[model samples]
Target: MAEDRILVTGADGFIGSHLTETLVRQGAKVRAFCLYNSFGTRGHLDRLDPEVQAKIEFFTGDIRDSGSARAAVQGCDTVLHLAALIAIPYSYAAPESYVDTNVKGTLNLLSAAKELGVKKFVHTSTSEVYGTAQYVPIDEKHPLNAQSPYAATKVGADQMAIAFQRSFGLAVAVIRPFNTFGPRQSARAVLPTIITQIASGKNEIRLGNLKATRDFCYVKDTVAGFIAVMRSEQAVGEVTNIGSDFEVSIGDAADIIAELMGRKISIRVDEERLRPDASEVERLWAATDKAKALTDWRPQYAGREGFQRGLTETIAWFKDPRNLAGYDPSRYQV
Candidate 1:
């Protein structure tokens, strides 16, 4: 038997970069498929340790291109597809792009993976796919109601992944994570938006839908869940959610973050930051039982205490002057 060689699409993005580094450190051969850009920017993957970065086989190409997709997947045993346009506000502006990248790009990868006989294909999904949870602890069976174009594209991509598995017997495991937060997160995300504003010495921060609730999982926990799903044969053709069982409203979360940072901060709703009335996902709470039963994956950061611990670490990372320099806290990030 040959060792499993992995190809991680979107290796330049936040979570993908971390996963790439972890796989390299674990002595796995990884081909990192980063988006090609004129400036040669590798996104967050450039931040990895010199030695770790050196060990990765870098393939700079666009996931939207089928030729490039197959080239990256060639000789790889596992495909961790994470490339997609993920900003909700922007998705509202350009939905066609989401379909091209999220749905079509996934098709290209699935086609390539099947053609090459890849052993496993781990597809990424989001809690946004479930909309404003009609029931508490939304499980794999929860009805999907995409509240935004971004979520809609994810749903499309997820369905395509499952379809490939069912139609061709291509190994696929869909990992749906709810509100993962930690270091290296872009400022566009709610947690990063709040933390960056506070770090930049703002007493008042602009926000939207603070009452919306979320089950926030730490990045490490979420990444571990993905690995567990990849290792489990039973997870093939299944969807598992990675999240903290606990939930908190965005407003209360801000208060907790403020307390953790020792900063007294106030949040004011920025009209521009608010999503359209019907598009806002007001609540999300993940039922982690499926992930546990299928992959033996448990979120180390669960509940209010875990949330606080995760925030403390995240705050410290953002407080570092070097890390904070990458973001402009004054600008409203979409």
Candidate 2:
């Protein structure tokens, strides 16, 4: 696997950056596809060690553009498609962009991978596609309910991947992860929002939907799951879920972070932070039986101890002046 040429789309993003680094460390020749920007930024990839950065062949392009997507997929044996418009709030404001990027962008990759005959094509999906849990532990068989436009686009993307596999025999594997969080996550996410606020010396933590519960998996664990899915022959044409079965409410998660920071903080319900009631996902708990059965994969980080350790590492990163400077705590990112 190390000698295989791998292309990771969205290689500049939070999870994508970490996955790229992991692939490089394991001795794979990686081609990283980052969103083209005027400032020539590589997003979180710039934060990786200089030595790791040097090992990757970087390509700047938009996934929505067929020519760019085709160029990146041409020589690669494996393609991990992670690029998409991910923010739910932003999706409400701009649904067409989501369709173009998430739906059509995915179509671009699927078409390219099929034409190029990539050995493995991994498509990234989110638990948001499941919406609120209709049952205690959401599995691959759970009905997909797109409660938000962002989720709807993802649903379309996931189906497109499946369609490609059935119609064109594309070697596609879909991995749906539940609430992945850790260092490099932007403030738009709840974990980073709480950590950044507390690290910035805010006494009152502003949040929304405290009662909402989620199964939070550390970023490393989430990346590991991706690797597992990529390697397993059984994973081909299958949608596997990668998550810790443990669940925590938003209010309790905040309290845990405060405890780890060694500071007591007041919690405030900020109206702006709340999502539209209908758009909110009330609960998400994953059932990893299929992932375990198919790939011999199990989450290394689970429950309170894992959560605390991940939070500690995340808080440390956000506390650094260099890193903190990149974020504006005063403005609500979204």
Candidate 3:
């Protein structure tokens, strides 16, 4: 790790920012690939510890462009591809954009990695690719059933990543994580929506599909899983599930958050927040045995107790005035 030079795509976003900071702290030479913007903003990376920020080489470009992808991967020995358009609702309105960025962008990275002979190429995948769970704890062997355009594109990207390894002998791996919630998360996610509204002193929380279940992994655990996958030689050409084997329904999660906040609240079903009936994923729970076998990685936060502990920490962070300053809880975020 200390000898590795890593390139992290989507280094500007929630999980990406945390991963970048951790890599630098561990002494890896980190190059952060942030989406180019006119404002010169580095997303959450801009708020990282000054020392950590100083250590990262921030490159701004579009992942959809092959030229940009190659340039970013040119000198890096390893690449962690986390860049993608992730919002499900937005994906319905812009399915073509999802294909361009998630699928084509992934092909661009895979091609570059193969050409450069990267030692390890870890591509990020989401549990959404599984759609509604057919079994209690979904595993790597689970059949992919994408209900949304976002998930479909991810499935395409993931297969292309593995195909590179099979076809060109590149060292490629994919890590699929379940619902990940933490500080710095945007309101587009349900947990953030719940926490933000509560922090804003709202009693009536707006939500959708309360019956759906999720396996929520804390950000720190997910980051550790990514690092584990990166270091394991057994992970090449493999897809590992990184999640807690614990499930909580959306309705229950909101109630739990309210309990932790010591606030009694009611969930108001927001019509606009509901997904199309056929597009909704009714359940998700990950089986993480493969991750443990590969890298001895396990969620530090596990089960009901750990879930609550993670929520407590997240609540404390979002409750801070400085942290909550930019979040608008009044509006429904897609």
Whole-model lDDT per candidate: 0.93, 0.93, 0.94
- Maximum-lDDT candidate: 3
Candidate 3 weakest ten by summed lDDT = 325-334
- Runs in model 2 deviating more than 4 A are none
lDDT of 2 by residue, 1-334 (tens): 7779999999999999999999999998999999999999999999999999999999999998999999999999999989988998899999999999999999999999988889999999999999999997999999999999999999999999999999999999999999999889988999989888888899898898899999999999999999999999999999999887789999999999998888899998989888899999999999999999999788888777887787788889888989888787778899
Worst 10 contiguous positions by lDDT, candidate 2: 302-311
Candidate 3 versus the native: TM-score? 0.99
| Residue 56 alpha-carbon offset, candidate 3, angstroms | 0.6
| Candidate 1 C-alpha lDDT tens digits along 88-107 | 99999999999999999999
TM for every model, in the order presented, reads: 0.99, 0.99, 0.99
Residue 197, model 2: Cα distance from true site in angstroms: 0.7
Instruction: Report the lDDT tens digits of candidate 3 across residue range 110-183.
Output: 99988988899999999999999898789999899999999999999999998999999999989998999998
lDDT of 3: 0.94
Compared with the true structure, the alpha-carbon lDDT of candidate 1 equals 0.93
